[model samples]
Target: MELQHREIPVEFLQRLPDGIKIVKRHGKEFMVVEQVLGPGGENLMSDAVHIHGEPSIRLGVRINGQEGLIFVDAFWGGHAKLYSFVPDLAGAAAEVDAFVPETRASLMVNRACDVDGCDCTRSIVLTLPDGKSRVYVCARFGCPGHAIEIADLPPTVSQTISSINFFGVGGSEDDWLDQF
Candidate 1:
């Protein structure tokens, strides 16, 4: 199936529970996508923003950075928070997890801030169920903390390829993720 993308703006977010926070001190919302861990990961397709953990079934959110995979051990409760460059929120809705690795991610991306438009660029290497790793580039942007998933999904593009880089923070297979 061809990977499709959708863009949700900060001005169009829905209301969470009574006391749920949705924004960061800096105030920047990003298109966030999550995959739930399977016995070892998260239920990515389901937005368990409120209930994000299954201690017996730990899920993780691994950001593909310039250096390598930065895996964060996510939980289902306690200290739930979000970070952003926009300043207007106490914190955004996110799964409660004990951030692992305890280090900053190395993101050598072409990030920019525009008045009405912006698209960050990067490449990702996704390992499929079969242990076969394929690169993916997010084609669009999504709202952080929202759960919208497409599973058992195959790389719509790239053949006999090494890597691919994608545009937009949400990913859309438009970029190439490579290593050679």
Candidate 2:
């Protein structure tokens, strides 16, 4: 499916919360996650692993009873992930239990994914520097479902920002986007 790139809401840019920033890539502006914390306030940004030329958000995850490390893209609405160990996702709706790699604090929240055809009821929550703002990602592997909630911004603005997918749906790395 073709991914639609939505313009970043001006209100959000004016009141951009901490831990998230706007970046210029190929002369185009994009929102990126600069930092995120686990439930125990452990920094989940890994400088050692970079995705899309930026530090990745690292997390420990257990999928289908197999535990491993996952480095995720920091770009907002991006779903690129690198797994330390291959997960045997028997089906598309497989769920994951995500936690802090250092403190093991649970990052899973009881939130249902809004993506159609996906029945995942759990989400991985990443707290932004502002504390009140959060980024929620669907726990189901291969599901590009995520949402952003900013404390000061309107819910509609946050929702609109959450819908920006640069690499297209399913996080397909199409080189065509690089031309922009």
Candidate 3:
């Protein structure tokens, strides 16, 4: 089935996880997934890991332009979780995550972008004044890039950031993808 006017295919729905669905509002396309839950049975979105799940982690499939660019915004959890097993979803999948530098503008050591089917670790870090910074894109050109954010960085990175005294870092090891 196709959405009104946009003619964008709806079959992509079959490619996503159970809790995720797509919707169009005001001519823009968006994917909406239920917020994940925390270990204590609390709404993690309201406590820690705010705005990192659900509609925040959008799955964008190209409508016409390049024909297969699947763009997913930065999300919490490991990139492996983001890489779905769905077939025929073409084009490169671009994902972004956040990271915090230990020192001012310190060079980020090379780490492979962990998004499934991707192997790039090089990234361009954009540091903010409050240490809430983001890595814009993959260092490699054209392939899908993983955006590294403190909210979404792997557990090891999160632990490291907290150890260094970065501000506004939260997301327990027990954070559930269903708590959004």
Candidate 4:
């Protein structure tokens, strides 16, 4: 898959949410999640596990009946993840139940994914520092479906940002970051 670099919407930049920030790499700008919270307000960013030189969003996950931790890349539209244990199933077959590692509060929500060919009905919701904004990720393993909702920004801007897939569809594990 080819790498895609989406331009950040100017409107989003003017009113950037609290937990998200932009960083430049090789003269290119990229959005990164600085902080995220669980439903119970538990901090999800872990400095111990970094991805692309930024702290990863840590979550406890139960996949295929096995429980473990998942450290997800903090980069906006980036789906790179490090799993503590190998999952026995893949794709739509592997259902994930995510939670706060500290509070054990579920991050799951009953929201259908908008990605084509993905029939996932649940998502892992991560609340931004502002509380009103949220990042929703598909709970189906290997599904690259996510959406962002910012209270102060227009839906179109959020949708455009959500459509960005830096490593391309289903190619989150690619080493595109190393090239930068």
Q: Candidate 1 regions off by >4 Å?
A: 1-51, 55-117, 123-129, 133-180
Model 1 residue 116 CA deviation in Å: 10
Better of 2 and 4 by TM-score: 4
lDDT of 1 at 77: 14
Best by lDDT: 4
Q: RMSD, model 2, all Cα superposed?
A: 2.1
> TM-score of each candidate?
0.21, 0.92, 0.26, 0.94
lDDT of model 2 at residue 175? 56
| Candidate 2 lowest-lDDT run of ten | 171-180
The clash number for model 2 is 0
Clashes of 1: 30
Give the per-residue lDDT digits (tens) of candidate 1, residues 1-180: 222222222232442122113332124322222222222222323233332231121222332221121222122111123332222223332112222122322212222212134243332222223333221322122222111112333322122111211133444322212100
Task: Write candidate 3's Cα lDDT for 1-180 as tens digits.
Answer: 122222323433333333334555456554433442222222212222224343332222222132221223323222212222233324354333322211122223466654455676655443322244333345443344444344333555533322221111242322423332
Better of 2 and 3 by lDDT: 2
Candidate 3 Cα misplacement greater than 4 A, ranges: 1-109, 151-180
- Angstrom error at residue 7, model 4: 0.7
Clashing pairs in 2: none
| Per-residue lDDT value at 121 in model 1 | 38
